[model samples]
Target: MTDLTGTSFEFPGEYYEIMRKDFRNLDAETEFLASLLPDAGTVLDLGCGTGSNLRALRERGHRGTGVDQSAAFLEYARAAGDEGISYVEARAEEYRTDERYDLVYSLFMTLNYLDRGRLPAVLRSVRELLNPGGQVVLEFGHLLNFVDSFQPNSVGHHRRDGVLITRLARQFINAHAANWRNEETLLVRTADGTVAMYDNFFDQAVLTGPEVRELLAAAGLTITAEYGGFRKEPAPFHGRGPLVIVATATPADTASDTAQQEENQA
Candidate 1:
């Protein structure tokens, strides 16, 4: 019941990077993404927080554009001075560009943040943004994973460069609605011995395997692969980890014909 929401300080991008450093395997993740794309291909990162993945991909010789709604995260990403990588402030679902990409990816359970009703729009946008033979990689929290591993409360502490951050988390699962709520409080101490607290919360829709497949299909995408983690571990229907999906867009002509047919029928 500890709520740090009363604190005035907003979560900064520097601290966000520090918080993720402990768990996020940047090399493995970038390798996985690289394996999916051709050499020197263009990439789009939806909900790309702080542009970490894009920055990593840029180093691997790929050009990347990242879109996120958080201005603080975008500001930090732009300040990194990474060549061939750019950051834009926009919601994933509403983001549109004349530029097509060889690959589009969303990571870190970003899709789960959207309501179920909004998934089609997001997926459709992804499909439209793909170049010929383009693919999309999505990472989301699977319902089974949450069911298998549900911890109500946890605490973590990280220290770097004279900054100490203590994070407390609480989670609630509503099976009936297939919803997961995570609340977090962070106490950050600077080198000057000044301390500040911040609170964050997320409500996620835990979609079933079938629901995910159906949504992808509805967006004119075909699943090419599925994985349980960053490694190429198979994601069985009853898997117990975050779902990583690889999908390719349907042929543009075919998709266009299907849309025309549907419109005519309606």
Candidate 2:
């Protein structure tokens, strides 16, 4: 396992394996999201690590482009098989695309990487990068699930290629969301007394449902749906895994009343 930020180092070999192992459950979720878009023109994947999700979308017959702050991730994504995927190396806040996309997606709680203040800017950028009536699917772990825990939450032990990998993570909850700063250290113990170690930080931001709706609303978008898991199920007050939100960019005038109504009701 590499440090959470270690993915910033361009370690594609390690990342691809880690992500494949950890994100297996997101496949259904991604499919559900992709279904909401039109016969895609351009699909922008924010925080597209290893471009796994992007590749998945492409396999479904959509053209995909990825944006990430990690150069290592970008390098790895570029070399991914059956290439046509365009990858841009830039921070979520700093990167901008000249052309808007039919769909702009930030999956797996990538939005939580930015502080509350930065969210508006990021949302606006997504809005600007979206074609009119385009949809943006944002996914994240629900903070409400961990609101009671001041300690860490750890789970998962699966074997891969003769190596047994286990993950342990700690959770720190604050007003905004649960800061799950996971330290996933992979240790491979072998018969020859050989051991390998990789440390990575898998940090995620957990926001309340209202907080997410508000953030998108402020950015001139409307929330169409939210799910507790990848199955497109309703997100009750409590749930495991991530929150999947589907929003669409709205014009400035159309954004005002609808967003206010949602805020007041929430």
Error of 2 at 3 (Å): 16
Model 1 misplaced regions, further than 4 Å: 1-10, 174-176, 236-238, 252-266
**Residues 1-266, model 2: lDDT tens digits:** 32333122334354345646566665785678678767745688888877877777787777878888777677777777536578888767778768778988887667877665678888988898888788998887565654544356665665555555555545433433445565556555544556665565555565777887878877888888877767877777545556788888777778787767889999
Give the lDDT of residue 112 in candidate 1: 84
lDDT of 1 at 43: 99
Instruction: Kindly give the number of clashing pairs for every candidate.
Output: 0, 14
- Candidate 1 lDDT, 55-165, residue by residue in tens: 888888999899887888888888886589878887777787899999999999888877677899989889989999999999988878878878899999988899999
Which numbered prediction scores highest in TM-score against the true structure? 1
Query: Cα deviation in Å at residue 201, candidate 2?
Result: 2.5
Error of 2 at 134 (Å): 0.6
What's the true lDDT of residue 96 in model 1?
77
In Å, residue 220's CA in model 2 sits off its true spot by 0.6
TM-score of each: 0.88, 0.80
For all candidates in order, the CA lDDT equals: 0.85, 0.69
